[model samples]
Target: RVKIYEAMEAVILGADELDMVINTGNACAGKWDAVRKEISDLVTATPDTVHKIIIETCYLRDEDIIKASIAAMEAGAEFIKTSSGFAPAGAVVGDVGMIKQATKGKIGLKAAGGIKTLSNVLSFVEAGATRIGTSSGTSIMKEVR
Candidate 1:
């Protein structure tokens, strides 16, 4: 279950943004309402902070990804992220594009996980990712320079 009070505690502790992972189990079980409700509650709990919901696309089918993206947008998430970077794979261009279509530009898109190069970053951006999360920032910056 989503912990609304704990999320509020983070806000009270001075966190300005939150990146939350949706329950992939519920999503895989085809519980769209549960998925949406959890995200909505989190958003409602911390209205002052930016909410970025990680759908963990690597574990989902294309249809699930699309559905999840739409649900997050409707639930008031500011961004729908591709992964938490702990999956078997990270963000992919195709997934990002699919998520973009599902959200219809109403919400932001973030590409995370395994993004290690400037080329990777550029590809995701071209695919409609508005934000990028990576651990290779230093190397990626070197590529830019």
Candidate 2:
């Protein structure tokens, strides 16, 4: 039920956090005003919840990524995340580094997708990612041991 809930609707239903993808095409085309408005609308609705804006870093240029990160933050995102995990490639160290630098620690960064190893986790952390989103948690724990 949670996964199927539309972003703001989920927050209304008591979700503590909301991570939803916007129309990435708009964001990628430098259409920040509309994208910002959309994201802000959700943020306004979820004032009590942690709203994460997924920018799909794999699909944008560094400048575009930075712009998306700032727009999301300015619009009230608690975090700016890198992928929906449906892209051919997921979070990369360079993308994380750029986002970290762009946000300047004002908002948290979540590095998700294709993160299968401890080193991959550390790389993102070192780049200022505050959260790691991965399906390989158990394997990462095993690698730590």
Candidate 3:
């Protein structure tokens, strides 16, 4: 973890084009407050890296989902992402709605986690996801085209 933070710091310091930070670990799943605080401190210390927090929705309840979303935004996260894709469940429309409601237009929402089909991607977009993360980006764009 320390190594990862150091590496992130290095990236932030070295890359002039670095514009965002995505936290892709499920280890920070239920500990929303702590995760938010840590990310806030990290970004504050850097002040240039934009933060995105990914909450593993598979292991979180609806309340936790809401809390995490709000906490991330309050902590200065630029985006609230759903799922790290390491657990049983992935991104779902309902969870996206919760995040949207929690953030209330303060931050962008990213829907990832097993999103392969165009219909799934559309569902997330319709539900207020501003970004899509997937290995099937090509296929999805083809469908859109």
Candidate 4:
């Protein structure tokens, strides 16, 4: 319901990708249905656009991360993203690894937030992250030595 409007609004504004936060609260509480529904809503709203569902791994347990990632993929998301950068923690190599393994070369994986180093970004890539998100773009780029 919420993501329906927001995703449509993003599409209207010409967003090439629709990245929406999963119902992290409900997801952590073990309510997989609500989380998957939210992702599904956005996917339906943006059929032709890329739908990235951010699982916000910082607040989730390892099991929850796997569940949420799988749910997002089952609900038709094109990408499973880790974190919104608003939480206390951000994307980790382990989390990315779990997500990558779950995706099984089916959907894309995006690692975002707290990714400040070249090695960190590269590690996520090696873990099969197709996209890297960070606020420290310049410093990360400077590591090209």
Which of 3 and 4 is the better model by lDDT?
Answer: 4
User: Mind giving the per-residue lDDT tens digits that candidate 3 earns over 81-121?
Assistant: 78666667789998998789777878989887899999998
TM-scores for every predicted model = 0.96, 0.92, 0.80, 0.93
* Number of the top-ranking candidate, with lDDT as the measure: 1
Expressed as tens digits, the lDDT of each residue in 100-130 for candidate 2 is 8888899999999899999999999999899
Query: Which residue pairs clash in candidate 1?
Result: none
Candidate 4's residue-wise lDDT over 20-136, tens digit each? Answer: 888778987899998887777778778899888888898888899889989999999889889888888888998898888877858899899899999998999998899999898
Local accuracy of candidate 1 as per-residue lDDT tens digits, 1-145 = 4367778888999998998999999999999999999999998889878999999999999999999999999999999999998899999999999899877789999999999999999999999999999999999999888
| Order of models, best TM-score first | 1, 4, 2, 3
Per-candidate RMSD, Å = 1.0, 2.7, 3.6, 1.3
Candidate 4 regions exceeding 4 Å error are none
- Better model by TM-score: candidate 1 vs candidate 2: 1
Give the local distance difference test score of model 2: 0.86
Best by TM-score: 1
lDDT of each: 0.92, 0.86, 0.73, 0.87
lDDT of candidate 4 at residue 64, scale 0 to 100: 93
State residue 2's C-alpha deviation in candidate 4, in Å: 2.7
